[model samples]
Target: MKTSTVLIVILALAVVALVARLFFFSKSTSSAASAVMENLMTRTSIRAYQDRPVEDEKVEQLLRAAMAAPTAGNRQPWKFVVIKDKQTLKAISGHFNTMKMAEHAPLAIVVCGDMDNTYPADGRDYWVEDTSAATENLLLAAHALGLGAVWCGIYPMQERVAYLKDLLGLPENIVPLNVVPVGYPAENPKPKDKWKPANIHYEKWNGGDSAVR
Candidate 1:
């Protein structure tokens, strides 16, 4: 073959290889991304709890599952204050924006992140994110066990956090993330579909409709 003809043949083969690589890479990425979205969408939050008290063994299992969640750098900076006391539960309920369910919940698990344990000498606090993950795991585990749970915010609310600290005798290093009130669900709340077509963007932020499957 002439040199010019040989060059054209080589370039054509290179283009075919590049196209094949791009197609497979795109398919693999799309499959992995879809799996992640499905897992996230299946996890739902519950609030209406039944009068049944969670067993000690079950509580321990739930806590173990919660602590198993991934942490930033595996710092494991979170701590939990489990409240089964009725009077204490009532007191904490008073601080909540909505307190109707506090009277009925069998127990409350106060999720706290230790800022002291999370610090890496950079003066940055990763405790909030770490503890949030732990709290979500706790809630998910509760739901999986046929229990109901509600996440009531506490940390950033200075007054509520201070009250909980004083009530629970929490150390200065510990920052309360939220109180998860848990029990067997008294009401089975229907899960709402929060999927919005316009909220999803493909490859770029074109504000196009979500490609709902």
Candidate 2:
């Protein structure tokens, strides 16, 4: 074949290969992104719990997942107090009326943000954010593990916070953020899709698709 014809064929083949690569890469990336979004969307918080208890090993696994969450500057400034003690759990549950659901939970986890452990030399505060991330991880991990969990706020509520502080003998630097009740779910609830396209902006704040509004 002529050299010109040969070169033209080679260039065509290269163009085809490039297009195929781009097409496959785009599909793979889209699939991965969709999977991640689905996982986040499907995760739900459970309120009603069964009488069944969570196994020690499963609880440990959940905690491990919680601690594995990313923290600001990799500073894991969080401590978890696992309350399996029946009396202690009952007492803790009494502090918050909204947390009565915890009464049926076989195990409860008290997530505390430890400023003493999380503070940088500059005295910047990262405890709240770090502890929040940890809490989210715990909740998501619990749902993924076929366990029901609910986050009952505590830190911001002065009465509940003080009660937990006094009851647990927590130091000044340790602040209780939330009490999570974990156990088998007695109720099956589906998660809602809270995605509002209007809330999302692409590139700039071009106001997402009007259909979303």
Candidate 3:
């Protein structure tokens, strides 16, 4: 074959290879994104847990995820108390009627908001929102790690708050938000679909047909 014709043939093969590589790359990227969505959609509140312990590395990952949450004005007013002692867990379960599941779980993380470290002015209440976001992240991380967890709320309930403060030796500035019990799942439950069409408003409340597309 002529020199020009040979070069053209080589260029064509190179183009074909490049297209194939791009196609596979796009597919793999989409698959990875779908995996993340699947994890989020499948995560459910697991109250029953097996008699198994979570690994230290997984616990670290859960905390890492918790702290990665966003905070107001970067105040990041949050603290976590990791409870693994069996007696303490039992005490928690016994003390709070709503937290009976804690009696059996191997681990519980107490998410707290630090009043002294957060915004002191109008944004003072932002600590509650900040710590709540961290709690959600911790729960998702636990589910992703194949461990079960349920958020047992504490703060806002004066009795619960005071009890945990004394039990966990929390400081005056630290406020317990919730206790998350995590362990190997003893039962599997489907995630609840909370989508509601009537609850959505387009631009304003009662926006009418303009909301529909």
| Order by TM-score, highest first | 3, 2, 1
TM-score of each: 0.74, 0.77, 0.91
RMSD of each: 9.5, 5.6, 2.1
Candidate 1 lDDT over residue span 106-201, tens digit each: 998999988778858763467788888888888777776778788888879898889889999999988898888889877766666986777766
Clashes of each: 4, 0, 0
Off by over 4 Å in 1: 1-44, 121-123, 207-213
Candidate 3 stretches with Cα past 4 Å from truth are 1-13, 207-212
Stretches > 4 Å off in candidate 2 = 1-38, 121-123, 203-213
Q: Rank the candidates by lDDT, best first.
A: 3, 2, 1
TM-score attained by model 3: 0.91
lDDT of 2 by residue, 58-84 (tens): 999889988998887888999998998
lDDT per residue (tens digit) for residues 22-65 in model 3: 99999999999998898889999999899988999999999999
Error of 3 at 47 (Å): 0.9
Candidate 2 colliding pairs: none
Give the CA lDDT, 0 to 100, for residue 109 in model 3.
Answer: 94
In the predicted model 1, the residue pairs found to clash are: 49-186, 50-184, 50-186, 197-210
In candidate 3, the residue pairs with backbone N, CA or C atoms under 3 Å apart (3 or more residues apart, or in different chains) clash, namely none
- Tell me how far the alpha carbon of residue 52 in candidate 3 is from the true structure, in angstroms, after superposition: 0.8
lDDT values of the candidates? 0.82, 0.84, 0.93
